[model samples]
Target: MVCMKDPTVQTICEIYEKLSKLDNLSPSKNVDTLFTQLVNTCIPPYPIDVTKLCTQIQIIRTKLIRLCGHAEGLLEKHYSTILGSFDTPLDHLYIFPYYSNYLKLARLEFDLLTQHCQNPTRFAFIGSGPLPLTSIVLASNHLTSATFHNYDIDGSANSMATKLVQSDTDLSNRMVFHTNDIMNVPGSVLKDYDVVFLAALVGMEIEEKMNVVEHLAENMAPGAILMLRSAHGARAFLYPVVEPRDLRGFEVLSVYHPTDEVINSVVIARKCPIPTVSSIDHQGFVTQMTCSKCAEIQVFNHQIEELAMEEHIC
Candidate 1:
């Protein structure tokens, strides 16, 4: 339905061509002004490659952080400006049905995962922003309820999120919000959570993000799951792109797409046997599990490449 002749399509293609040519993907370095310009331009929402678009926006945001510094909460300021207030939040209104697609997609992914009825009933959501949208959606709709541990670095946004949670009696009873830097939290805090959601734009640098992933391995209770939120296809940069290649210290179980209009990818990973640094593979050791009774060990050669199964329909 979209024609190549459209100026927006032409501009998008041009941006892709430019990004493909650039050798340096460093955020510390200044990016071509055109890519940033292309992102901010009033482009139509029709049939766009959201993965590429979000990646480009992510580049622009990282550059902004590098140039402006996060000391004054520059990144949060920018994100909040774009998302606006959650009071009578547009996402909650869902005047446009697709507006809540992100939340629906998240819930669907959770369902796709195998849950033992006895699995821990606690979860932590990082970078929950002004309204813990996904957490809210899941907690309110699911047949099974779990405790939610939410965190945000921005003080004002954290307060707003807390207020939002309090406004709902069910959520106030079910959710807890913490105000702290996502990067600085002590690993001890990870002890109580069964699952942790890593937002794509957690306002941490690449190194900081990597540190969080590593710390989770050392701190999360045994059998805990880490649900990594990332932007994949279409406007991936929108969620600050993360691939299996960009991670360490956890065993990725699967890569899945939500059965909705939103095309972001959700990667589910779990803690593997802790190994010496020299023995670790791309992410972590190959999956290995042992039966408690017979002590029979099973080796799972499931790497990200071979992990995808028919667990969930996209």
Candidate 2:
């Protein structure tokens, strides 16, 4: 839907096209330069109403996501290959370009999870890519005892990820990878996890994203934590935006938008114990089955909404 005549749209399209066709996806001078320009264009230095072009940008979001996935896979594969040769590969995690970002993100998620569940026994990560750095970092630094179940649709990515962590004796026992679509994962299996982390790139389209959310809502244990990655501001062009309303069976606890290099915003929610009421009473009161979990979520959601507005991050 983008107008080819518009200079900004044209530039973005051109850059995306070139980037998609590139044979070498590894970190290189040319790849970095193109990605830099693309980022600058998508997120300008000065605010200029990027939302107006959101519809147009969304038309090509699937392609952009695919390109990003492929690029990330290549980068991870490269790193995995290099690290596979080392005896203490986990110790050399600093060599990764986005190692710092992963560390910060994992820490943030850990803090958020701890707020609701003090001592989580197990967690599931959907769409954990080839490197699975977030899971690695969280297991290594934060929750040392918690079992990690990583799910990825791509068998090759799962294979690569297994290779990366298989050498680490600590992680080898705790980290488990499943090569299957999250949709196919049974509810019985889902209810076992104390917390679930949905990766940013899991669902490329809004419908797909919502379907996954709905599925999790139906399956995940009541009061279990669900942490998902979304995007805000201009970053929505790169990743799907998960509004609070889209989470029907979950009570949103907090939404954190990072303005720095960490692209995906984090949304933490807890599954409702029972079905939530969809309508308001004549007195304009939200009618719901009252419970301890509902009471806590209502208080936290109100505070989070106010904070989001003041921070302009929701």
Highest-scoring model, lDDT: 2
Worst 10 residues of 1 by lDDT: 291-300
TM-score (C-alpha, index-matched) for candidate 1? 0.61
Please report the candidate that would top TM-score against the real structure.
Answer: 2
Residue-level lDDT tens digits of model 1 in 166-258: 656767788888888766676687878878888766634667667677676667765577787654333432335555655455666666543
Q: Please report the TM-score between candidate 2 and the true structure.
A: 0.81
**How big is the positional error of residue 276 in model 2, measured in Å on the Cα after superposition?**
6.0
lDDT of 2 by residue, 112-168 (tens): 667677799899999997789999999999899989999999898888788888888
lDDT of 1 at 45: 36
